[model samples]
Target: MGFSTDAIHAGQEPDPATGAVSVPIYQTSTYAQTELGRDKGFDYARSINPTRLALERSLAALEGGKSAFAFSSGMAAITTVMMLLKAGDHVISSANTYGGTYRLFVHIFQQFGISFSFVDTSRTEQIRHALRPETRLVYVETPTNPMMEITDLEAVVVICRERNLISVCDNTFMSPFLQRPLALGFDIVVHSTTKFINGHSDSVGGAIITARPEHGERIGFAQNSAGAILGPMDSFLVLRGIKTLGVRMQRHDANGRALAALLADHPRVGQVYYPGLPDHPGHEIAVRQMDGFGAMIALDLGSLEAARAFLNGLRIFTLAESLGGVESLACHPASMTHAAVPQEDRQRMGLTDGLARLSVGIEDLEDLEEDVERGLAAMKS
Candidate 1:
């Protein structure tokens, strides 16, 4: 089946008992057992829930992976993937990454004896130089958070495969609609379903999908052991959100590209960073790997004062931290999402105080443009 059909029908069937079209939420914590050793499909919610299982299966199919595991949050999914590596193992990660992910690696993971080295994965030589003898994984977020910088997935995958290292890509920004990392030879794909997958911004969830059965097993073990699985209600919500993913993504791409074009031509904007832009450094790679340019865009306002003025002046775009919602949101990475990173390091990664990340919504093009214009005018004043 095609992507749209899969989005609507995959892992979703009319409830056999009630004939309901939507997947029913099984809210129980435990299932009834006929015998001490046996139960009816489920033993415990922590181990497995019918609703959550359906969502997982749907995501796995969408991403073209063998299996998928849903988590309480994006960090939970990431932590589970990290748990696959033991103490003394090292990870080579993209220098520009999600702030929360960076904190997990630099702070929390180190406490657990795991180490990491950050490098610009866009450059093959940089990635090669960052790898250590004990490196077990190459982690990256392409079209990286706030910056929208693209990494060459094919190059990184080849390098990791040759070095016997796991290749994991965060597909949150592009989601399954725009890019499928597994099909591009990535060993594992991760998503913060709180964003695009959920589409509506109503739930917080995450998932990990993998083509390899062993990798799935490792993540599954960690998921069950850690007991950070998504709740049945949240799972149902995510499933509902995913049903319209293809449709929503079409609008997101159109709005994002249109906004990026406008920002690039604006006089007040110092620079616009979006893979959809022809002049963008990673446009070619993005065209090769993704079906659409995606909904995320970043702009440099020239200074912190200008950024603050633009953000505060915008009436239509909400000033908030999260992205990928149906409603437009604008945030400063230096203060909102990537604040955890040291100011010096964030500057090095191009996440300056003047940087503004916008998640373009499905709003009308004219309205969005006018909203952005108002903000730009504020910066001038």
Candidate 2:
């Protein structure tokens, strides 16, 4: 079936028991055993839930992966993937990764004996140069969080194959609809379903999809052992959200192009970070790897004072931390999302206090443009 078809129906057959169109949320803690030891496929809620399994199957088909596992949040999904490695293993990741990811690696994982190297994954050579004998995985975030930097996924995958390294891509920003790293030979794809997959801002969830069967089994084990699985309600919500993924993303891409253009032309806006822009450094590679230039955009206003004025002026765009929601949101990355990173490191990546990341929604272009204009207008004050 096609992408949209799979999004709506993969692993989402009508309920076998009731013929209901929607996958029923198996909210029970455990299933009853019919015999001394044998039971239905599901034994415990933590190990498996019908609703969450449906979501995992749907996401796996969408991402072209062998299987997928859903978790309580995006971070939980990531932490489980990291569990595949031993304590002494090392990882190389994109320098401009999401603030929470950076914090998890440096502050949490490092204390556990795992080491990490941050580099500009857009420049594959930096990733190559950072490799050490202990390095076991390369984690990348293309069109990276507020910077909107794109990495050459094909190139990185090639390098990983040569080095026998496990390759993971955070598909949170682009979602599977926009980019499928697994198709490009990535071993694993991770997502914050809180973002695009769920589309709505109502749920917090994460997913890990594996291209190879071995990785799938290992991740499945970790998912069950760690027990941070997505609850049935959130799973059902994501399933509902994905049925319209194709259509929603079309509006998001359209609005992103329109807004990026508006901000670029605005006199007060200093710099805009969006791959859809032809002049953006990663445009060529992004064109090759992505289905669309998603709705996320970052604006550099040159100072915190200017950013504040601009944010204050917006009526439709709420100031918030998360992205990829149906409603528009604006956030100051330096203080809100990337605050966990040291100021020096944030500066090195050009994530300044003046940088505002916009999670452009599926709203009317004219309304969004007017709201942004209001923001720019306030900067003059």
Q: All candidates' lDDT scores?
A: 0.92, 0.94
Q: Which segments of candidate 1 are over 4 A away from where they belong?
A: none
Could you give candidate 1's per-residue lDDT for residues 316-367 as a string of tens digits?
9999988898999999999989989999999897888999989999989899
TM-score versus the correct structure, for each prediction: 0.99, 0.99
Candidate 1, TM-score vs. the true structure? Answer: 0.99
Separate clash counts for every candidate: 0, 0
Q: Each candidate: RMSD to true structure? A: 0.9, 0.7
